[model samples]
Target: MVKLSNTEIRKLDDAARAGWLYYVAGKTQDEIAKKLNISRQSAQRMVALSVSQGLIKVRLDHPIAKCMDLAQKTKKSFWFSIV
Candidate 1:
């Protein structure tokens, strides 16, 4: 891992806060920018940086079993290929 200088650490912290506000708090980028006292473009960049630095994590939960069963039934009943 690369060492971060104090300024870099502060920037990362700001980015993480911006990301949390946008993702978890459901704030708009404009709102985040206003709240953080930064420009909209800066807020956008901070959010992206937070994601790139692994400060943000995203998980998608899918019902694969249910979907597969429904697809199989549909294919059997309709004789249609589901690819």
Candidate 2:
């Protein structure tokens, strides 16, 4: 599991909803903002955060395995010790 900052954790639900509203329900950022009672910029940022944080996948056409490669590199860089 990935660790989340307090703010990121708090936004997870909204981010998921925002992405769904934009992608599945076909809502514009302005519409989403109205529905979610947030600023349009917040709506847009939530949609992007959902994708960047992997809260949801807007499409399945892209390969997620490439992300796994980056994860491995990060683990090697930060968590592994030289022997």
Candidate 3:
């Protein structure tokens, strides 16, 4: 992995916080901007940057039985795990 300077680290932290506020806290860009003491456009960019940097992850949780069945079938067909 590449090392980040303090400024870059600070920006990534801000972007991650903005993403959490918008996605997890259900805040709008305007709200995030106000809460973070940044401009709305900057907040938008931060959220986008967070996603682009893979700082935000989305998962779909399926029941174990369904997931297991799907995984088994996929493995049988493909001879490898897709999960």
Candidate 4:
């Protein structure tokens, strides 16, 4: 694998964050630009960079997954449950 320079690393970091904000947080390009203090065009470019570089991933989570996770957490936690 090719090593990234400091500038490249920073760019990738920005792209990853922008991609997450867009995909995960459901932020628009304009919102990302406002939050990052960059132009909307730059925000769109960063999101595209993340996809081109394979920084984003997609997975389907089963609805029961959340219930199972909660069960595990309850098993470990000291808190009392009302249910």
Candidate 5:
């Protein structure tokens, strides 16, 4: 892999921001590319990197607990339980 310079790192950061603002935030890729003054492919690649780096996190709010009391209370609060 090519070592990135400070400038290039800054560029990468800009790319990351553009990617998150566009792809993850539901803005169009074209708009992101245009805003970043880069090609659409570059924008897409940045988004891919964001995911690969674990910067893009996807989660379900279900909690796992060994405590019976907490589990029972949670189950009572929520209609659907996933314990």
Candidate 6:
């Protein structure tokens, strides 16, 4: 298990939202956990917590093809890298 701070937990909350979105979109918990660099159990728990905590909304928007695109672009523009 990994130890996390309140801030880190909040970040994980965002991750939880993203992970839940992916899972609800059909990806497996293992896949989401792998992507998030955590355990499958953590992924499932966080995703569920996000839903239980009302941190995420279940909306069916057209898959935003530019979501990751904009993320990458913002990274480049701001010289902020993830990883």
Lowest summed lDDT across 10 adjacent residues in model 2 is found at 56-65
* Ranked candidates, highest lDDT first: 1, 3, 4, 2, 6, 5
Give candidate 5's total backbone clashes.
0
Q: Give the per-residue lDDT of model 5 (tens digit) for 4-76.
A: 8999788668767965876577877777788888898888887777667666765545544346557777888
lDDT of 4 at 19: 98
- Output the number of the lDDT-best candidate: 1
- Over 1-83, each residue of candidate 4 has an lDDT whose tens digit, in order, gives 99989999999999999999999999999999999899999999999999899998766599987887788798679576635
Q: How close is candidate 6 to the true structure, as a TM-score?
A: 0.47
**lDDT scores in order:** 0.95, 0.87, 0.93, 0.92, 0.73, 0.74
Error of 4 at 39 (Å): 0.3
Model 2, residue pairs in steric clash = none
Q: All candidates' TM-scores?
A: 0.73, 0.61, 0.70, 0.68, 0.55, 0.47
Candidate 2 lDDT by residue in tens digits, 9-82: 77898999999999888999999999999999999999999899887764445588678667878878899743
Candidate with top TM-score is 1
Candidate 6 regions with alpha-carbon error over 4 angstroms: 1-12, 58-83
lDDT of 2 at 52: 92
lDDT of 1: 0.95
Candidate 5 least-lDDT 10 residues:
58-67
Scored by Cα lDDT, where does model 5 land?
A: 0.73
Clashing pairs in 6: none
Write the residue-wise lDDT of candidate 6 on 5-27 in tens digits: 99978866766665565656777
Which residue pairs overlap in candidate 4's backbone?
Answer: none
Ranking by TM-score: 1, 3, 4, 2, 5, 6
